[model samples]
Target: MKYIFFVLCWWLAGTLSAQQLKGRVLEAGKDGNVGLPGANVYWLGIPGGVATDVDGNFAIEKRPNGRLIISFVGYASDTLEIGEKDHYIEVVLKAGHQLDEAKVFKRGQTTIMNTKSPVIEQVITGEELCKAACCNLGESFTTNASVDVSYADAVTGAKQIQLLGLNGKYVQMMTENMPNFRGVSVLYGLNYVPGPWMSAISVSKGVGSVTNGYEAIAGQISVDYKKPQGSEKFYVNLYGSDEEMFEFNMNGSIHLNDKWSTALLVHGDWMEKEHSMHHNGFLDMPKKAQYNLMNRWAYKTDAWFVQFGGKFLDENRLGGQKGFREEMRHQIGEGNLYGISINTRRYEGFLKVGYLMPQYENTSMALLVNYTDHDQESYYGGYEYDARQRSLFMNYIYQSIFGNNPNQKFSAGASFNYDNYDEIFGDYKRTENGLVKNTPVNPQREERVGGVFFQYTGTFWTKLTLMAGLRYDYHNLAGGFVTPRFHIAYMPDEMTTLKFSGGKGRRYAAVLAENAYLLASGRSVNVAGQLLSGRPGALKNLDMEEAWNFGVLLNRKFLLFDRLLNINLDYYRTDFSHQVVADNETRPGMINFYNLDGDSYSNCYQVEIRYELIPRFDIMGAYRYNDARITYSAPEGLRRVRTPLQSRYKGLINLSYYTNMKKWQFDFTTQFNGPGRLPGGNQQFESFQLMNAQVTKFFRKWSIYAGCENIGDFTQKHPIIAADAPWSVDFDASRIWGPIHGRKFYVGLRFGFDRD
Candidate 1:
């Protein structure tokens, strides 16, 4: 037929050079049915714009001038100026569903990309920790072998984080994903989250598929800060270390004209530090000052969208008798010992809203809200502690799939949470020969908790992806618990892949900041006493410490010469038949928390490797293992014991090199710790502990670093006083583990600015 009449004359000569505009994507003062999916339609410099199809109808063959633009993602992005003729447009997208920040696709390193997410994700940039000159956020990546930081005992200088070797309180640390630290902010909140306001820090190890909750069993740390449209126009930093700490960090962002934008952050730290009183005669670490302030705001309008932020923190901690003076604990014993003090306060606010509907084509719906206030007061050795808190959170959302194969997709959600708690626990009483009493042994507590959740996300066969979730919680004292989650990822071709993750979680064990050295060695506290209110307790009828953890994972990526190679391994098993596990080796001042006998479990493992080797230069390595135990019940059966500052093997090495004329930089890191199981029964120390390192660098706006930490200053020699029960009553300082202070040489500096 004459070649189909010359292919319809070249498709009508490209539709007469295109020109036609028409729309409906509704949801603004509704009246009848409506829909709004993905919302976004363009013409702000011409070039075809369309992103709304799941029914909210839209058709435009490029022709509708006077700068037209529309946007989405928590709404607010719209523009339309003086149209000469044809026109019809409507947009309103807003719904900040509690949390979701999974979108970073730049793909490079033996490329074979196409994602639908089932979890096996990795992205650690800020130019890859810029060689970890990271002076904040607890030693910035310390050569990150999937994150590890531990040093909790040996007297409060606090530090905790261990993923895959488990028990960093089972991961789940968020900021933009906002559950922002958990419980009592996990002791020190990693030095008040300041690593120059991070621009990226997302690491997931296992069990996090049920809409991001039940509770990640052993992994999840998401932090992304540098907004106002991807900031970086100014920043500054400064630091000093050599046991006499010092720090200062700052940032700024601005743009308040076309649809408004703003950001600001300030940081401070001062250390009149002097570590090493080695506890024996008291005093290990305590002389500090820290502060933080943050602010953010954003706005947009095509339909509507809004954002807001606020934060403030102040802290001071003092260890004990380096020269004692806490008003001298009971004059007669004037040598007066042990000291610790703290004061903390916090406030926060967040919001999100969206509505757009009119049938399907690109349909939409959204809502999210948050609020918080927390306060604290603490002291030790004359005993005094106080705490106050308030919290609230909400979320709701719905997204589309649009017809048969734009790759079928769907999301459903609902959530609500609330909390209130006030507390106090004080102690001091002695007689029978020693004589020191002022009539004190107190406990006054109050609590309220609420929760609800449901979530589902699905996508089939672009290479498989499935996420299922469910959560229901009620705790007045650990009454009800139900959490179920499932995650899956399968792509067996682009090179190779197959992954599966599992989940279930819950926690509460703050009987005095997780055993503050068993009430600083005044002992005598026993729970399972039915969550305690006072009784004949040594663990008298308890419940409210339930746990059931299940996990599995395997990741693999490859490329030999063309660069890019990665391999990851994971295995987790945590099963607890109600637990709190903390004992003091049978009578000796006493200390216990029950619910187990002959066996309780936690077995963790990890292996990692990464190589960029070419572009700028990068190298990575990791190895971790943990097998914690504590199983006892009956007239003295199964007394397992061990699990504190964990270290049964851990190794790491990291290196970085950067360029793009973005200033000079180079970093080197190292870490190694092996040999676990140490708690009272030392025949003169030396059960393994070694940490080594080095650093060199250059940065713009602010940066300077000098290092040598424990340059093999390994410790744990003569772990304090226990020269065979010196002061009788079997002297005990909570069986410390490793690093009682040794090896020191340091230097530091940093500056920050971003959020523009």
Candidate 2:
């Protein structure tokens, strides 16, 4: 079977190679030629186009006798005729008409859909990020309809995301195309990246390419940070909220020479005040303090490029009853108050190098290396948990045209992943016959994997595109496996596009770390059979989880009332072959882990529309439906039931308007959440609505914005069961369905200096 699949992939790749046209666009500067980023390049009558990269580099399918057009803001548009012999070209653009006392106005879309790539992708720009109080990555998805962000539990204040009706772990997370936020960091890693340091975010639906890894079962999300060589010289942001939360951020860039540049980013935030707005004895939010820092350096030459960076973070959190403090973590008893405390310190570093081959046209090779060390200590009520992780990753790739055919391109790569973990978890205090006891479980593990992959891309007639990839990996623990992915895109006209994608993905489950929030409850932890009978200190020998995903998308654009209107529709389905299930409903007062023995699947559908109501006024609306189920062991054998705490449907509407001079902006958003079944599928939650709004005023060199969240002040009732008794078996904080806190207001200021 493997040999037949390999032969089929190779045969499909040999049919589509032609020729490609490559070039660079630059602006005529006083000192020298400056590369212009974000320039639009397309054929004169083509259906799709592409934008230049950060270095003003672009590649397109070569068509004989076709006219190519390039244009950018504040620059004159240029058109040129292409010939069969031309493979590379360079063009310089001059400034557009200038008036004596008039200003040139330019506006760009806050969100964009890529029409050229084979994969379905959406880009969120920095302008859209400012619509709300985006203090961290967890809060940046307020305007997006596809990704849903929610709190994991009521006490820890930890946030998690859902994509295609699946958990965040199934969705691969990346920073600048590198894998991150794995293992122990999955719970709180969303809070590490400061919002002020982001430039853009890209979200791709369905399974991604195999070059990254075999872990993207649902989708992929990649974040792009502000570059060191950007036009910004210095920037700062200050924020304060109604809950007495204060934050400060600053970043600056410096150029050492013509070939070297560096940037420094710093962030600090604290919330020392404790509040129990519900008067339920338990605090609504955690008291927290965090400090983060990063430094990056970049070097570029004609044929070589190098970039290196390092980051450090330190954070502390305290939460529980209203009067509980961090100092009372060890004094939990009949007379003492219940408390929760967590402390974390992390370090990360990475290096990337790329080289362009002068001997071959459109050929390049690159290498990437990354290392991370994370340590955490925490205690929930009478339970204690401590963990440490060390991970290293490396990838190398070679890219070039196939047999001098510009229309056919291929890339081959190899990757290595290593991980070491140490964990200790148990209850420090146990009550038995009016006496207290102690029980602890310690488990350690190390993993190593090496993989190689090949990917081929082919384009025909500038309307149809096909991409296929295959990868094989050998794991020390799981033996060997193969992953295959395929994608197809077709454009029927200038305003219509259709895409289909399918792929297979696999990964090992990190049970204890991923479900750390369950510790806040009084439930006991257990394993299904004799997996931990003899080797009590060794980790469970569970099967690696595997799944297949398939999806289809349709995008159309047309004129309505003489204005452009866009509509998008998509559907995806995921089927699991092997899964490690976390069964909390089968047995009351106990959390059990076991291997799956039946069916598990998820189906998702979404529709989105964007239009302009009036000049400078834009509106967007979206709706999504989900059907997810899992099989679990019950008192009467096995049964399939709906997943707990997952909403059946969601609706969103967003409105934005700005003044003519762009000095003032107003934004409003509304969301409707449908009810879902609670644990055991015995009861259903009630539907609710939420509203948010913001207003911003811009000055010459700074801006001020204010916003309010949960304008309706709608919150879930009794989010925590048996809140009055923390040591009782009925106490559970993991069954969260909606907001735990009430309305909140915040104000912020941003100042920046532009480079000449």
TM per candidate: 0.29, 0.89
Specify the poorest-scoring 10-residue window by lDDT in model 2: 97-106
Model 2 clashing residue pairs (backbone): 18-406, 18-407, 19-406, 19-407, 20-406
Task: Score residue 57 of candidate 2 by CA lDDT.
Answer: 63
Task: Tell me the spans in candidate 2 whose CA falls farther than 4 Å from its real position.
Answer: 1-101, 428-437, 528-536
Judging by TM-score against the true structure, name the best candidate: 2
Cα-based lDDT for every prediction:
0.58, 0.83
- lDDT string, candidate 1, 430-543, tens digits: 556553434333443334445556555566665667766677766676666777767777654333345666766666655555445444444555565332222221223244
